[model samples]
Target: MDLDQSTTVESTQSGSSSSGYCRTNSEISGFSEHLTDDFNSCSSETSSPVSWPVTGRSPFRPTLSRFGAIRHDHKLEKDDKLNDQKPTDLELEMMKERFSKLLLGEDMSGSGKGVSTAVTVSNAITNLYVSVFGQHQRLEPLYSDKKRMWKREMTCLLSVCNYIVEFVPASQNLQNKPSMEMMISRLRSDIDINLPALIKLDALLIEILDSFQETEFWYDEQGSMSRNSLSGSFRGAPQPQRKEDKWWLPLPCVPAGGLSETTKKHLRQKRDSANQIHKAAMAINSSILSDMTIPHSYISSLPKSGRTSVGDTIYRSMISTSRFSAEYLLDCLDISSEHEALELADRIEASMYTWRQKACSNYPKSSWEIVKEKMEGDKNVVLAERAEILLFSLKQRFPELAQTTLDTSKIQYNKDVGQAILESYSRVLEGLAYNIVGWIEDVLFVEKSMTNQQES
Candidate 1:
């Protein structure tokens, strides 16, 4: 069955486009008329369809019409017209063969074989929606009725899946099922009554389709024995052999001892790249910590009696900085040992406390005196310069130890830790998107239901 063709028919017959729920033809015609006018400007013959030169610059560029039709026009010579007037039986048969090949993805043109199937399926789904709903129409109402929305979504998803199962090669389809299932689960859990969530769901669907298209599976030929009239049992035509029961091909395995020298070199480069990223992150964290100041509200909340104590003020500031610094270091280093991390934090706090005690013992003659001298002499310019230099140096070397450790792990394991970190970030973003969709749906559903109950 031609899934794409069947879907088009179903969507058209269902009155999904004809009903008032869909956009009016005037809105669609207006856009198409605008485009037609633009194309008509570039061509002298307005009555005849304009064929844009594919190779040369032309204002009448080949484009898809608002109604999802290609607007390219081809010029026909006398001989071409004569040939088109009466196609021979052989030519008709050849045309049908080519069409079948194109639909089955046997003739991919420029695209790799089996890749066009996914594109065809995805385009079919997109065109179905575009035709029924038109562009720029709000989709929030579709989700207002949860039962209706779920039924529609499920039908569309199952239809697409069924189409794939029927038309796509079994091996390739099996390979793509896991990713498709993941995308569907995400869509079901995450979609909400909002344009952004709808768009995200659409993108995920497209990605799943692309994953299906990218998989390529080949069958091996096997010989079969057959009896012949003149000869004894002979080998017949070779039949395509089915692959083993593996869902996916195994990942490339490393040697027993370790990875090859080339792999080690590549991993070293990846480790360096990861180290650079870690350094940048640490720098940003340090900058934020250095710029952090006690909030006015916090200061106001402090006891008025002891607020004037220089030692107490200094201690609070030191504690905040030390805590932030410790957390930042632990994060950058990717330290999993909570005990060790806490121990390091405790040491920092202890050092800061000792320093505060010494500074407070000298009162106005201690570090306060140096600050006073700098303020009086140079209006704190020297102090600011020194602070900047210190911060710059710390930022440059803060991730050195962490980077060294990462490099050692990469060498030993022959894996790109940085790439893993990047993948983790992508997963986090996907999770956040899902969570946002769920939150919006929950809020909208509760509010709407409550409003209905109040009205009744």
Candidate 2:
């Protein structure tokens, strides 16, 4: 059950983590007996938390018409060196955009390129989910049809960071905007004001994750029981059973394992190319972020207490599942046996594979189930938001997102675990905008902060 961690990738200076696994125990075919549960008259043991009222900024709007790809480590003042005798049109345009970014080339930093917190935070979200499929051996057949949950979860986490990054002063006063004291004050006040809302969103996120584990979700027309509750578990010798079993359901998985090896190779190559996000999630303590605090330039905007910045909780939540395999599975499920570990893996796979997108996929609008009374002849009460604007946006974007449904009313969605923020095209557009804005602003934020420090 204990796979060797000898070949694990070394952690980066940013402390990015890498998952490791060894030798597939593919010999074990069918599990002892897939536990078929009867939830006919059952109630969930896991109490859903109170619904948190979420207030989200309409994220992702740009201040510029066109941005050029330019990276430079500037001093506190411009050198004004003309490397080019005559700059080309594109080069000139790029320079203009860069000027706007760096307060008209006032010099945002000294020498070294600053570390972006967005990249660092996003990296933590990715690294923390070190699982059997991605970090372990790359299996092809088990991909595409699954693993999308991870993608969705990643989207939401990045969205939060992206939205924050959008704060880079889009002010026309490029010369006056990057004031050391004023900008610092604004960042602190804004983060403090937003902390309560952030906490509410975090609570809602916890509720969303909790809901996904219900047995109700396990019964979609063609689906089977959850691997979280395998009855006959492992055969050879008796494996330990979880003492407390909840509503006959539990899990999260990405189907990256099912894809073809070619696709696997491509994804692996892409992972290393963008190393910015790896620097994320270096710390998950305290709410006050400052030079006196731990050097968390990557997440200086976030409160020391920020758990998810949306990325923080995700790393913690999925860690359970990623560790839910072979020997490590024992730690997750509180059992110690190789066969049971293997069986649990299969059970989780089976359970995870059942969550398909349907045209009428129905989950609750309220994070917790809210009931209505027929007081004063009440009109009606609605639970699940099952009407799909039907991927009106998917057609233009991911037209292939078939077997689909939509839930427009809900606010919870992510790029990693699973759960669309909303089954709307706006979510997609918003995410794209979030990233674009974040990319531009983070560059300015990191560099501006570092150089401001030197100047002060």
Task: Return the TM-score for each candidate structure.
Answer: 0.20, 0.19
The models' CA-based lDDT, in order, is: 0.28, 0.24
Worst 10 residues of 1 by lDDT: 23-32
Model 2 TM: 0.19
RMSD of 1: 28.9
Candidate 2 lDDT (Cα, 0 to 1) = 0.24
Per-residue CA lDDT of model 1 for 1-456, tens digit only, reads: 112333332111112211211111001011111112222222223233212223443222222211111121212123234423554675456446534543764433745554244333333333334333232111122211222222233233223221111112122135645533211111111111121222223333222211212111111212322233224211221222212321121111122222345434433333333223222223322222222232344333333322132234333442342333423433455645423433333333233223333334435455644644545434223323332232232323331112112122222232222222222222222222222222223223333443344456
Instruction: State the lDDT at 372 in candidate 2.
Output: 28
The top-ranked prediction according to lDDT is: 1
What does candidate 2's lDDT look like per residue over 151-191, in tens digits? 33333333442223224433333575663331211222333
